[model samples]
Target: MNRYFRLCIFFFFAVITALPSQTSASWQPEITIGLSQGLSGVHLSSTSGVLYVYEDLESKPILELPQGSELNVRILRDQIMANGQEIKGDQLIIQPGADGFIRVNHAPYRGYITLLKRKGLTVVNHVLVEDYLCGVVPKEMPPSWSAEALRAQSVAARTFALKNRKRHASEGFDLCSTSHCQVYEGMSAEMWTTTEAVNRTHGEVLFYKGEVIDALFHTDSGGMTESSENVWGSSVPYLCAVIESQMQTQPWERSVSLDALMQKMEKSGKPLGTLKEIRLSPLSIGKGSGDRSLSGRVRSVLFIGTTGSVVLSGNDLRSIFSLPSTLFDIRFRGGEVIFSGYGSGHGLGLSQWGAKELAEKGKNYKDILLHYYSGVTLEKLY
Candidate 1:
């Protein structure tokens, strides 16, 4: 071959090698989510095809039911009973055939179902990570929000799920299907807009120093976000406090009578006689003081009473009173203790409302993500 032809072949091979590998293109991880626990019985069905039932430890399917068939699974002491038939194993896997989804108690799920016997019958959904996010994004944020905001939520939710994949391992699954993990409503909750966002940012995650960061997020930040050390008591470099470009505060107020406040404190195991006064600095946004975090969220409050006194953290007060957030001002007026606050949820990482505002202002998903999670690189891990 001529020298020019040899050079041409060399360049073509180099180009082929530079392209993404097949493994990367097809990389998809499965996530196991605990749907419900402590159930005496659950009804199972398939959307469009046959359902195959198998033991968790066996490869061969034990039973198969036609499309539109229903099976009632119940716990019989330590064994599982399917449609009154006693199954051999303690765990049973219900898989749908063809392009179908399995329904647990009339709710459609993307992947197969695993029914395990714990304290009671535990139902878990085994779904692909991307498909899981399709359910999560719509539930976490409004599906009608700007495309960029949905995409940002997708990345954050994906990173969080992959990072905390083993969160509920002891419970026989990876994560739970509640807000405590990530509110996953299965295929029924998947929307076109959110699914599109998930597809656009497929396999993308936020990484700090080559490791996936715990992408914690919240509903709204009053004006600024709080650091990990402030909210969770551990300093995470990427989870630092960041002020929103457009500070849109969500104001809220709740009033409890002095007698009611005392009763609440007593119910929480801290008995203060008669409410005296609440001591804390004034509300200062983004300015840390002795009693507040950098975002001005209460660090601790000195609760004085006639008989005894107690110092409670802002989080403590929030739990005690069911307040929206810890960023609040406590004032004693008349016979009541009034709590005036701003924002919802624990102010950490990405602010959902803040993301929506930024997206409306033409900021893309990457820009929104970097704005909240500091010093993180957006990479397509798959």
Candidate 2:
């Protein structure tokens, strides 16, 4: 096996075997994520404990650093050193203080940290997976929502984290602290409600055929959830279309000037010179009438312009116009193109608003998850 693959395998085994079982007891799995990049230097501190600095994952420490002593790290061509000492070898490991936080650039992260130079910057935050979820839950979904909705979001986020653990493996980390993975604000974003949700659903994940499924979610679904085939072209049985609620008409509208629309079209490489007219396939309120997805989202559109006409997919239109979703109708009126639509995000997986509505009407998080995800079982994996 290659050196990197061996190292990853070792790491995975270390994490998995470190725990007695997937459930029954809590396992503090280390999740390394890229926090920021292009940073020339970083400042770190811990409140208590004998902070040990190590070269990579070596047994011997380079320095048994003291607590509360701020270490300002600077990156050289390859090595990152503090106190004019060559501390970085392979990677730099900074163990956190006991029951305390590791302060990075003054912001505190609730675990030990590993610093590696990448693209001329330090990258890596070795945090406990549960602690990482604490940072992610609130930012991904509101803490004030119904308890069941928050719990549903917690399970979804946890499943997504574990399933996509190697999403940024080439970057020397598991995930990124942004929407690219999950919006992990670390410590500051944690709230009581979200924390409770995470604890209650500890180690729980959505499973399909005994493996963790991609528990994708969004802000709202308008009234109906979208199928994975319609959005990403790969259909997961659990991500099929469903009417989220009986009450429809969650309206959202946006208007852009003809010039703005043309500029966007030009930027997208499909320059329709002077705008002539936009022809949309007929659409209905719920069921897609013409050239629309089963959930009523636009499938394709024809842009007729003075220079040339271009046909674009609904996704392309959404991207160029900055529309909330593909489920929209285009109307040209008085030198402006107005897009009227429902929904906030891609409309796949569990909808936060839909979950809230269901929770309010006596649905638990498991029920909400099953309703949105089709056939799936919730399994507790410590």
lDDT for residue 117 in candidate 2, whole number 0-100: 73
What is the per-residue lDDT of model 2 for residues 1-382, given as tens digits with 9 covering 90 to 100? 3434534554566466331221212344667778887788888777666666777543666777686677778887667777578753556777765656777888877777777777656557777778889999999988999899999999999989888887888777888998888998788889999999999999788878766789999888878888998888887988988887753446789999999888988888989899898888655546875578888888888899988999998888888777888878889889899898888889889888899899999999999999988888887665
Quote model 1's TM-score: 0.91
lDDT of 1 by residue, 1-382 (tens): 3434533553454344221211112336677899999999999999988888887524777788999789899987777899888987678888888667889999998878889988889998878789899899999999999999999999999999978877998888888999998999999998999999999999888888766789999999988998889878889999888998755389999999988888989998888898777899999888899999989999999998888999999999999899999989999789888999988999989999999989999999999999999999888766
* Residue 130 in candidate 1, Cα distance off native in Å: 0.4
Model 1 alpha-carbon drift over 4 Å, by segment: 1-26
Q: TM-scores of all models?
A: 0.91, 0.90
lDDT over C-alpha atoms for residue 303 of model 2: 90
